[model samples]
Target chain A: MSLEKQIAISPAGELAAKLNSAQLPVDACYQCKKCSSGCPLTFAMDLLPDQVIRLALLGQEEQVLGAVTPWVCSSCETCTTRCPNGIDIAGVMDWLKEEALRRGYSIPQVQISRFHQSFLETVRLGGGRLSEPLLLGLYSLRSGKTLEKLKSGELKDELLLGWELVRRGRLKPKLPKKLKGAGEIAAFFAKSER
Target chain B: MKVSYYPGCSLEETAIDYAESIAAVAPLLDLELAELEDWNCCGASAAHSINHTLALDLSARNLLIARQAGLDLVVPCALCFNRLKVAEKALPVPQENKGKTQPPVKVWDLLDYLTQPEFLKSLAGKVVRPLAGLKAVCYYGCLAARPPKVTDKEAYENPGNMEALLRALGAEPLDWSYKTDCCGAGLALARPDIIDTLVKRLYDRALAAGAECFVVSCQMCQANLDLPQKRIAKKAGRDYYLPVLYFTELIGLALAHPEVDKWLARHLVDPRPLLKKLGALSAFA
Candidate 1:
């Protein structure tokens, strides 16, 4: 259907209009919970995928965007594949994640907003690639690994694992090096503000 | 026989063992891998989860490089393949590379590339030391086998390429349900409890099906499964030790690469004992 038709059909709800504007097929979902049932990580989500889509159709913008489902989603796409309406449900979650960021709604650890922020920083550190230790280190700092917890040995297991890998000669110490053409990639990312 | 290879960043870090194995076995399989020059990250799950355009742009850069190479791009890491395939899917319609006339570079998951019918037929003839008694389950995770429209994988939910590849190498590939299940990979650091739950579920089902080891192509799945066994065992109150070896590592073993011991040694849960018990370990490996 055309954007005109989508707008005409969903004129009553702000959320529906937003979904249509974003090109998500919000009008097609009929409240079948196949997405919810098939979701592997719903136990930690505040709203199931189906419930969030339903809220979007009803123009419940606050609930739709504020729900932790988007951040909790791992982009597994089982929900998208299993959807009878071809709703691109995982894409919906991605959109919601970005939307939530724009709208300033986030939960620190449970929803992974901090982790993602750290990830972008890590990527920038590598110019356009990823440095594993940098990502872990940045995330650990941003997620607020308190000194008291560190002193209490809360991270003992993780530290022990790190030591083991290092001892096995798996980790080589090095500073992040720029890729040959990374200057162009850096300018592109900066212009996009990603 | 020659393909541009994208090892992804994890292959340099957490999954270095998987990379070492691929380097050892690709030659034996008559596959030549030229690393995609100056390839960077595909933005991974992090870029895609937020900033969809950046995800596409990041992956599009790698795709452009692979197209310049003028060869099919074979990615051993499932996550990198997914991100690149996503960008490739948008090449024609999206404005990023709409006017470029170069032929679209074909992106292939390593397992799918290795399991082509002719390749499998040849692979069967090349296995010198058959892994006769090894029982392994192929854990695909959700990277390469979902959203069929994007990944171009038919029967996405029921992928059999890994099974076909394993069987050709004379290993018994078991039928299992969690083959395409998500192990909560992207959110692993954010919410480890969720990962533990998902991993335990898969492990229980795999154990029930009599699987001795897991063969994974994704390094994220390997880390998610391999790193948590001791914790899960303590929580579930059971002995914890199940090897999560990469598909490439197992192929190295089957092809009689003695240095497989070096790769397998990197795994958290040792796989050599099981291989030794079954007499599946190749000489000196």
Candidate 2:
């Protein structure tokens, strides 16, 4: 008799599989569904916590990979704590989100993603996180066509907060030093990409 | 003393300065950081609120991993530390998660890690340059001390560890009211509308406390306090500026240990003027 062929999984599927495998002892899942009940953003998810896991167990790569549900998770640990199964749902979700993004799927986090992208981009360029310029730049960029729509007086009001901090002894702006272990951090992210 | 170190995402990307300072000072204190291999996110507030078990599993995995690796984990980010601690407690409790192990590891926040008397003594012994007269507000955002389940390491934990650490380095750690206030962590994403209120509160409080500048352990806290305030100010029609220094930068400054230019000067909102006020320029230079 011919042996059944092994199914080839996409990067996300492979990631899910790796996560499950690495997440061995996940069999402890009691299915109490505390994770589902506790989640703040559960309503926003296309596939709730348990479904994501069930799909992951079934090795349903396409659905898990293509789903934007993973990115919607804010890496909050609400479900993981309540789960009797002892699964790191947040970690798994994060892994899935990272994997989905790696596979070239546009799992847009919308506003949050934009915020993350802008903040991280600023960090990537400057080597350390910056607040004022990052906010100004991101808000400006996000405003796009809306920039003109914002009343000049309102724009001035907003810009003045940062200016006030700068003027007072409160917010002092300076180049925050970068980490010596930056290469290690970069390597970790790079490895995750692979 | 050997401790496991979990430098969360921000420590790698946005809070690099803190990393650089740790690299410089860890050896001086004879404090060894054994970073766990194959660690995952600690599932900060967002993940925990989404799925409690998953969050515990993520942190438990790290703890179990750390237990297996033969060291207690030290997390630099308050959020990561808090999340992991919450998971550690909730996972093993019978009423909480009980009897599960996917990801396993015990986690400690940076302040807790350094507050260990032995470690503090060691760091104090190795201070080549003291902080002298520098005054800084110990800004501990809500993540480090609030939400009892997550930050159970201490009863009524104060953000004074950094201040104490600063004092150990011969710098003055200011007593400030905004130490445990919420810096509106990732809220800048979902609720940009209200972040100004949160950011401004922290800024105003720190200033009112008469701190020369603010120092924080979390990258996100610094970002929220430093970056989003501009927008919040823009919205509030007020100018909000506070030099948010990574605790490590202050450590480097106090100890006269300037290793990385990027680490010393990487705030998106420049901290030079504050440094000048603190009399840290020549030492940094």
Q: Provide the lowest-lDDT 10-residue window in model 2 chain B.
A: B93-102
Q: Whose TM-score is greatest here?
A: 1
Error of 1 at B181 (Å): 0.6
Per-residue alpha-carbon lDDT of candidate 2 for residues B32-128, written as tens digits (9 for 90 to 100): 9977776655545533443344445556666666766857688888777776776666555323224644344446777667766786677687766
| Clash totals, every prediction | 0, 75
Q: Write the per-residue lDDT of candidate 1 for residues A57-119, one digit (tens) a residue.
A: 877776668777788888998998888898989998888888888777754343388788788
lDDT of 1 by residue, B1-285 (tens): 899999998888878898899889889888899999989888887888777877888888898889879889999888899999888887763233557655556899988887889988987887888988889898998878888888888968888888988998899999999899999888777787888899999899999889999999888999889887888888899985679988888788877887989988888888999999888884864
Worst 10-residue stretch by lDDT in candidate 1 chain B? B93-102
Candidate 2 regions with alpha-carbon error over 4 angstroms: A1-194, B93-106, B157-159, B236-240
Q: On residues A60-144, what C-alpha lDDT tens digit does candidate 2 reach at each position?
A: 7677766656656644455654566567776677666545655676654545445544554444444423343555466568644
Point out the worst 10-residue segment of candidate 2 chain A by lDDT.
A1-10
- Runs off by more than 4 Å, candidate 1: A1-12, A106-111, B93-103
**How many clashes in candidate 2?**
75
